[model samples]
Target chain A: MHVTPGQPLMVCEHCDAVYRRRILARREVAHCTRCGAILERHQWLSLDKQFALIVAAGIVFIIANVEPIVQVSLGSSNATTTLWGAAIAMWNDQSQVVAVLAALTLFFFPLTQILTFGWLLAFARRGERAPGFRQAMVMVHYVRPWSMIEVFMLGTLVAVVKASSYFKVVPGAGIWSFGVLTLLITVFASHDPRQLWHKTVGSNE
Target chain B: MTGVVTARERGLVGCHVCGLVSRAKHVPPGAMCPRCHAPLHRRKTNSLTRTWALLIAAALLYLPANLLPIMRTVSLGNVDDNTILSGVIELWRNDSWDLAIIVFVASIVVPMMKFLVLGTLLVSVQRKSRWALKQRARFYRLVELVGYWSMLDVFVVALLSALVHFQVLSRVEPKPGVIYFGLVVVLTMLASMSFDPRLIWDRKETDD
Candidate 1:
């Protein structure tokens, strides 16, 4: 039952509810009585286990990028496209702005998030502060909202369903990897990235 | 509830990025968070004006996003321009009621709700209305929660457009409306981000 206390006080970002910080027991979560926003939590897993999840997500992300997301077969001449291939295909097809938007939300932002968290965890593993820790933490916040990997996954499913009627569309390996990556990322979200700032708790990993 | 103290009341500012509380009696405006380097502020600066600006832009684009054709399909040389609502109807007519509803809600219902809920929040905060502060706080969270889903349509358009490029059988291309719809999603998200929910409680705290 090892645990580390965070700052002496905490404030709810969503509702401005403040509380005297509590040392949470393992798997326990404290919610703001005022607005019911989560104030703090004792994460279910330590940093090491969480870092492994992020690494798995990273590998899955690469597979999602490289493999074909959708394969179209019409009379033996089939076309298969990966996520990157889709974005590049769109780029060359005259809708460049939409292409960039698709690429950024689906690919670039998630990659940055995985790499940033991975970097932070590597330093935390050794009980040493990561370089540019402040910038990295801030980047996590800004990037969280924009990284719509799960949204992409859902939208991709929707597209696949809608397109199958008109074409011989088969869901490819990339789509399944995207589903797995979405689940891994959701697990990552449950940990609350800000918890990484607690040096004592982080060192417990 | 009677004697509760906020972080601000004790001269402590919480780092918005990391949630770390710090004494902030003499720090300059826009002081960076000591732990995370995010700018610490009592409240988001000009939250209302910025929110209103983005909301107005989104509102302006919403019409075109829904009216103009978002996708063009050429089947055997017959061209068809499909707007968002029409796309939903096409899906419905094609017997995909679930996908139709999903697209309808994500692309249409979600943004309209953001504009209305956010507009209400902004006006309520500006009017210093003490009505339903807790519910309003929840609404702010709801706004943030649903904002990203609005991008569903844009991604749908991008993916479908990326596919369906067959030379002779059929071709689907993204039209002007998707870009506008995409911009609307982005703007509303920004507006939601800029409008600080803390303002909903400012008036009540000061009355004490």
Candidate 2:
């Protein structure tokens, strides 16, 4: 069986003229103003780049969860907690809502999104079209809001400050790592969407 | 009633791109034309109302978030209560200035910035103004991106509260600020969601 690569095609709304991706990118306007036809719209990223980013993000994510996020000390006592520790603590405190929210938003959702994106991109790079491309894309959209590590981080900071009067507080290495991870996820996720869409749907256009 | 059918009715003049009404008749389907390629719809779905609802909720929550206590810590048979700012100050006193600053910025600064920036954007779009389209979009993205950092304060509190729960020696309890902080997070997220990106483009188009 012969497999053909997906090529970029732009269909004009007004003139119905189809232009190649390169041609559309060079033009100032993506659509014909006079006839109201789409002058340019095409896929932009290749499979290799998508897979590389997914792998890099996954490694950072693991580091974020495993390391100590912050350390606290009261007189002679000191302790540290990782991302998982925070989740477990919340559950034990009977704040099940907060615990579940923290778990899903900070850990579970991001993990699932990263794994799914990586699996799909890796498979697609090898010329094997993954089943349920659209479903995976929808899952990405759903998981996007639940990736709340950054928010959780901020809340932790506030809580630490408020608690400092009685105890000494220190930001652990995990805090810094988590910050880096947050930035990485934001930038990578934004870029990844465009790349993924291009790989999956732009090729067909 | 007695007139003959025109060429326009024969799909000759209809828009070739979006399939809207056109004046010309028998315009070849493959032929590139202006009207046929125009956008089918450019407006957002109830943009103003949605933005207002989000902004109002944010404004309402912003109050309790600052007023309520975020964490309560007990140590050496003494109970010391503090809010978000006090926490930062406490960290500063402990020589953890860097961590203090981070907490302050993430918990206090970022949340306030989200409210101000989002409120401004919402108002600007409602007025259909064309000022600072690119800058506004950047601000919006920044707010959305940083909104989650506020959770740090909550996590730290929960963690400390758990670790220090050593019955007579020390115990830390979550203050009312946890609820407020959670509200702040939700409100900010809602604010970001309510402000439509398309509004930025719409105003830009109007200006152009």
Candidate 3:
């Protein structure tokens, strides 16, 4: 509970009750006394494991973008599109705003989040803080809610079922990769950035 | 025993991002929190008006979202255009009861409820009605959380348009209505974000 110059003191976001901040043991979580909200979550996974997961996620993300996500055949004509193509198609068809929104939520923001996490984690692993470590962490938090890939997947499932009545729809390699990427992103995003920041600052106290 | 004092009673406000507490008077517009370097606001400025504007825009878009075709499917030279309601009905007719319910709730029920709940919250807050204060706060939380679920319909349309393409046999394309529908979802989500839940408690002490 010692208050140091650089150490952050916390208040409950929901209730505004001030409290001293402390690093918790693995699997430990600090809860707000007034509102019962999670203030911090410290999990047991070391930095390396999280970094490996991020690398795996980045690879999967690449595959998702490169491969065709779905293939459909109706009588004599068939069409296939990658994730990027889906948004671009909309853009070409005059729905410019929706297209841009789709691109940002589906691709750009998520990519930014992944890249930021990769940079921060890489620096943290070497016990060196990145120049923009704080800003990157903040960006991750802001960008997280906008990444709607999993929701898009759910929509895809519904769309596939609806389309099945008219013609044949086959899932593609991109679909598989997209699914895997979604899970990986969720796992990595769920880990608290505060704990990661603490790890990067090191045990030099 | 001392009386229970609320945070607002102490003139304190907490930063949502970093949980930093400071005197509300000290946090002017564009001021950053000392601890987290995040922008500090006593209350989100113009929260009510901004939320109202966004919600009204969503309401106007809701009509087109439901009335016009969301997707057009062409199969063997036969064209079928389905609006949100028609699409739900088509799912029902096809015996996909589960999916039909899900689409109906996500696309139709949720947005309508969001508008109603948000409207009621605005009215209550404006009038400073003390009735159901806790419930109103909880309701706002629910709206904030589930606001994005309405995007389910937009995603479905986008994915279908991308996937269901066959040169002459069949093709699925997004209709103009889907654009409006997507706009509606985004607007409502923004409205939810613009609302300051802390205001629910603020007026209580002031009005009394």
When summed lDDT is taken over every stretch of 10 residues in candidate 3 chain A, the lowest stretch is A1-10
Docking class for candidate 3: acceptable
- For model 1, how big is the CA root-mean-square deviation? 3.6
TM-score (all chains, Cα) for each model = 0.93, 0.67, 0.87
After superposing the true interface residues, what Cα RMSD does each candidate give?
A: 5.0, 12.1, 3.9
Per-model DockQ: 0.45, 0.21, 0.39
When sorted by lDDT, best at the front, the candidate numbers are 1, 3, 2
- Model 1: pairs clashing at backbone N, Cα or C within 3 Å: none
The residue-by-residue lDDT of candidate 3 on A32-125, one tens digit each, is 5544456677766678888899889888988888998887776666677887887887777677677888899888987897788888888888
Residue A163's lDDT in candidate 2? 49
Candidate number with greatest lDDT: 1
Residue-by-residue lDDT tens digits, candidate 3, B93-203: 999999999989988888988999999988887887867766776777778767777888787777777676566666778898999999999999989888876566555
Winner by lDDT between candidate 3 and candidate 2: 3
What lDDT tens digits, residue by residue, belong to model 1 across residues A89-149? Answer: 6677666877888889988899999999999888776666687776788898889999998
> How high is the TM-score of chain A in model 1?
0.88
lDDT per residue (tens digit) for residues B26-57 in model 2: 33334433422332322234555776787678
What lDDT does the true structure give each of the candidates? 0.82, 0.62, 0.76
Q: Can you write out model 2's per-residue Cα lDDT over A114-179, one digit (the tens) per residue?
A: 898887787678665467655575567557776776666555555555445556878877777777
